[model samples]
Target: MHIFDYSFLDNGLLPAALTNLTANIYALRSASGLRREANPKIFTELEQVARVQSVKSSNAIEGIITSDERIAAIVNQSSAPLNHDEAEIAGYRDALNTIHTNFKDLDFRQADILSLHAQLLAFSGNDDGGKYKQNDNLILEIDSAGKRRIRFRPVPAQETAEAMEQLELAYMEARGNANINQLLLIPCVILDFLCIHPFRDGNGRMSRLLSLLLLYKKGFLAGKYISFEEQINLYQQLYYTALQESSRGWHENTSDYAPFMKNFLSMLYMCYKELDKRFAILHGKKVTKKARIEATLENSLTPLSKRDICAILPDVSPTTVEAVLGAMVKAGKIRRVGQGRATRYIRT
Candidate 1:
């Protein structure tokens, strides 16, 4: 059996990948700065929508079952569903808001990440929130015939804590080394933590939040403007397949994280690429009123009516605003609220 070794980091493709990634990231940062100035409002609206979607998908993956209707209601009506699940969805929103507000200044410890997990599961009435699993855990596979099967199981409970501690130590060591690429280290840490399966529930959601926090620490603030969760949600089957591939033979003590790592890198690159496209559009000289409105809604605190939006830009004609709103509403990018004079508009 080929036992996977952490020391493989000394020989893996990580260094070459990190160097290339760093260069790309630097270029991306420059492009993003230019976009921020060129179309500030659109960028802001995109960020807001991204943040909300990220939180929603992250929670949903853990079986929280947040519906599109519930999310739409939250945004449009400030009204929440009366059901228990809806309450949990509301908690997710609250947690996401807290994370966003403090992400700029916060640095997380292992305990902090665990606590976030607890908060994430609290809405689902899972009491193990913020606590590590005390018993042995297993990943199970169920076939179409509904046969019970064990996929992967962690080490004995006696060794679980020590294993987790070692993982955390590795994470901290990499985090403190300025020479190490934070992006590479973050996914590694997340992979290892998931392998550990420390918490009884909400492990998946917590791992994602940890990923965001790590990215934020590395100055990947653009993630807050876009979601890894949204990407994962769309490719959920692929996501699970990658995780399974990485963990295959883990019970036999094999180390093969290549598939998982590759998937993660691909997702990250996709986000970076998308942001690049948006930046390009922003910097282009032929910006339309529709584009400007999109950016403004992305950044706006309160959804605005056409008149309210026009109030902000005295230079833009009301006819232009009306035209842009009509086009956007047609495009399904913005939803109109109320009728006639009492109407308002918000990003959809």
Candidate 2:
């Protein structure tokens, strides 16, 4: 039986690095708030991009995937799911939408969790939705040679209900106390949920959906305009390393929360940073499109791809970006690296 208590967070047990990350996120949150107030309409496009990215990336993390065109159509409800994978993708889109629409009224209760799981698998028609697992499960790791090993043993089905009940109660109790930072609390609760592995299926995806719901409820709105799941998917190896480290000794209540907390906060910080870039690009209507593209490349800390530039400057046409990159490359202001889909540009 695992016990869930986040009161340890109140004692300033967080490492200095995590504390800095949290503080940075808070500062970024304030800036994000001001930007939202200043340009509310600009975020509509971002919201739409994030919605598709969240659905696609979250499912991709679970190995559920479809073509980008089909995913966009599925996410927008413009096309019906044409395969099993697309069906699951549609289900995640709906579940994410439900959280976005109704998070204010939702709680950490078992019923709420079950409902979200049910919605997550509804399109795929998994009967296990909205129900606890009736059998035990294991988290397995496979090596390159295809050998499988038990990564972690989750709570038995017989004990999952009681484990979940205690987890929700503990989370709510801590969440009510002002001493506990909700940012820190969110990861802890999510870690426990993964450890419990309540549903036979959809546990990973449900954790992500609940993460968005909890963050929204707590005023971490970066995920609304930037896909947190996409960030997780991008840094998936780091994500799993953090989860693996934090879940060690989780059953005995000796697990350390710092790894996962740091990773989680870092992802949120990235979302905010990305939002800052998006806002900066959209805010500069005075700059010419070519100038903006040039500046984006020159100022980037890493190389930028045509696709990356297009995403960062969503209002810009790809053809225009392509032309600017070509002119810049010819002028020796920037250089192209790699070729084809692997292509990227950097300041010369």
Candidate 3:
């Protein structure tokens, strides 16, 4: 005898919000492409390095970061008698690589996405891969005595599958309409998924990957292009805080997702802004070899050698630097002193 209130669907605000979010995403993508076109070599090289680093760091922190040091270390090192870390990292990397390579072809279906989650959790080495929980999970809170206590209980194990199915169905319905903002839909699905606590472990990591996958499917690949996970690492505390805030009293809880949504949007915006700035610096205007070398020397506090210059300016060849240095010496932008490996460049 329960009646559902569908007023939120009729308000028209959700559709409008989604439209604006999609438009902004497109504009950001165009700007990103323009920057890439301007500085293809440097932008591509730095981006790949950054992405790998981000993924590694995020995977390392996993469950250990949230619970206890011993637990964290065990989870991170895969030495806690569980030994699932390697498997988890591999699965996550595979999922990421797949998304990066075939972003456009992603169809956003439930089973396919769940399989990715299963792959991600395969590292947990648990038999629950791609399956819902069979028993109720407890949300634990720590007391002053350092004892763990159950704070909130979830729906029964038998009902877990049904709950997840409903959430997935809602997600599909929302996605199909296209008129609904994908941004709103993203956080909604993420929060609900966490609430379900579908898998036995690796839920947090899977949730994050799912968020990125959804974004890639919708063309917000700019975040991945510049390492959104790195940005999250920088604000790890806030990241967890937002998750905890969203999940508090989640069941029958009139909790507002505004805080979590705000943080998510802010992180996305920051990543795009940083990428934009980097693109501008790389492609804004071309500087001659001499000018570039002089600028590099002046900006760096440490003394630079030929090898260091090569590392910093990967786009410029070693022979090119040697040629540029010879010209610069004649032009007096730098004075090379000493001999062989001992030689160093100082701004004149």
CA lDDT, every model vs. true structure:
0.67, 0.89, 0.63
lDDT per residue (tens digit) for residues 62-158 in model 1: 6766555466465333795567766666655655665677777655566666656666666566677677787888878799999989877766566
lDDT of 3 by residue, 194-215 (tens): 7777766666777777778788
Best lDDT among the predictions, by candidate number = 2
Best by TM-score: 2
TM-score of each: 0.73, 0.91, 0.68
Better of 2 and 3 by TM-score: 2
How many pairs in model 2 have backbone atoms within 3 A of each other, for residues 3 or more apart or on separate chains, i.e. clashes?
Answer: 0
Question: Residue 181, candidate 2: how far off, in angstroms?
Answer: 1.2
Clashing pairs in 2: none
Looking at model 1, residue 60 earns an lDDT score of 72
Superposed on all Cα atoms, model 3 deviates from the true structure by an RMSD in Å of 9.5
Off by over 4 Å in 2: 294-314, 325-348
* 219 Cα displacement, candidate 1 (Å): 0.9
